[model samples]
Target: MFASDRLELAERYTELLATEGVVRGLIGPREAPRLWERHVLNSAVLAEAIPDGVSVCDIGTGAGLPGLVLAIARPDLSVTLVEPLLRRTTFLDEVVAELGLAHVTVVRGRAEDLHGKATFDVVTSRAVAPLERLLGWSMPLVAPTGATIAMKGQSIHEEITQARRFLSTWRCGEPEVLVVGADVVDPPTTLVRVPWADPKRIGWPLARDAKRRSGRRDRSSVKREVS
Candidate 1:
């Protein structure tokens, strides 16, 4: 939930999502009416799972779903919105400026593009990819003690089963499934949090690939860093 002081900002963001968000094809026209309930509030609840004053990176954050929402709700968190599309990043940059969210940073690039270059206390995503693929892109950006917290649907149990091999190969701890915003939202939000099995012994199965990719100069141009 948003604090009283931050409620107005949240409202403004909702309006933008209904207007510019829809016009740019980021949000569906049908979704405009239920933006608050289905999107904003659902995303806001994710704050409950995060710790205070942590650095967060939300990958594939098209139109900044949970990422921008988190920044509005928790001013203490330094949020980085990572998206691959320029159009989406444009809208995100505008929203950050309009809301005067100084702690937010907008990066136009894929999550994999940040591997070996940056890491955050918390890496987040919403319907970006499946569990197995998500682990490949997210784990590289998760700090030794940090975790990847993604919003998932009811098929989470099945997805976890399919990703069992990946969890073990990457030395990830048991995935913790949590339901947040039960009192506020009807069905509530389902989140899957995956952390390293041992902070002292983090695994980087793709570190070599990340380093090779990071060496490419072209990749740098694709990632736009806007504060």
Candidate 2:
């Protein structure tokens, strides 16, 4: 499902993950044997849920799991890999440069730090945190009309149930569970898709504050122009 150039890049990425990724403790050596199926392809399959030509931010992108994989599989996307650790971001930056992925940006910061600073059409995470805490960190990064997708394990439904209170408070629509890559990858990949609801109804404090700050900045600019 990838172009020739992208296919080559994916191959190189797999090799890097198996070698340096393991040596650096980014990935366990045991995982190297199944890196293609379990890690690279598993992450790549999530591309099925993402639309073409939209911006995406992958939170806590250690070893670039789904983030770099998505950039390889779908060249149409503009991807930002948000990682907090210096070692992980270092790895990600090198891989992006090596792959010549012009559309990918490696940002060294936690998701919470980006709130009000940036937002995207879609926000993503894999094995980041529990659904409740994940929503707290991810929801604020998604545009009002966007969605947050988490690569979850089999207990996805239970997590959703537990996150119901947070979901209601944040005005998130009902979470949709999806099994992607049914044909290409064995056992498929499970995902939890949470679309954003009306912010006014949900009472999103950060978004409101951001809006007010933006308005103030605009007014200041107008005053400077008048002066």
Candidate 3:
């Protein structure tokens, strides 16, 4: 559940997505009826995997799927919605302004183009590209010791197998597939979590203390949810 303010913003966002988002060709018209279940809630459930008070970058964020949803669900996070297209970013900007989400930022740029410019504690993407290619573009933006969380559908296991070589090359650990919001959302939400190698061993900067603090929050929240 969300607070009163976030719930109101979520409603407004859903309305915008069903109407303006459809008109602008961002979301298909037929998807309006299932917008809450298939799109908004599906994305929002990803917050279960994200830690509190950490930076998150959502790459290829079309219409701010998981990005905007995450910002709404977890106000503790610093969320960046990155999209390359002007039209998509325009829509995102308007939604962020209307929601008055001070913790969210909209950036217009491709993930590949943003290498070395910025990095995040977590990089997320949904319906973006194949897992192999997605890793190529997203992994570079993940802070050393950070993780890339990709929202994948049923074929995720196969994609992980295909991406094994890339994972090895990048020194990433084995991917973990998690199902979140099991009771809240039908079919739940599937996430492929890939953690980068230790920074010192890989010649990158050391991990930040902020991640540890957020990790503690993550554990506490999960405990409460399970109980």
Q: Global lDDT of each model?
A: 0.86, 0.82, 0.81
Model 3 misplaced regions, further than 4 Å: 203-227
Candidate 2's C-alpha runs over 4 A off are 199-202, 208-227
Worst 10 residues of 1 by lDDT: 207-216
Best by lDDT: 1
Range of the 10 consecutive residues with the lowest summed lDDT in candidate 3: 204-213
Ranking by lDDT: 1, 2, 3
lDDT of 2: 0.82
Better of 1 and 2 by TM-score: 1
Candidate order by TM-score, decreasing, is: 1, 2, 3
User: Could you say which candidate leads in TM-score?
Assistant: 1
For model 3, what is the alpha-carbon lDDT of residue 94? 94
The true-versus-predicted C-alpha distance at residue 20 of model 2, in Å, is: 1.3
Clashing pairs in 3: none
Looking at candidate 3, what is the lDDT of residue 209? Answer: 22
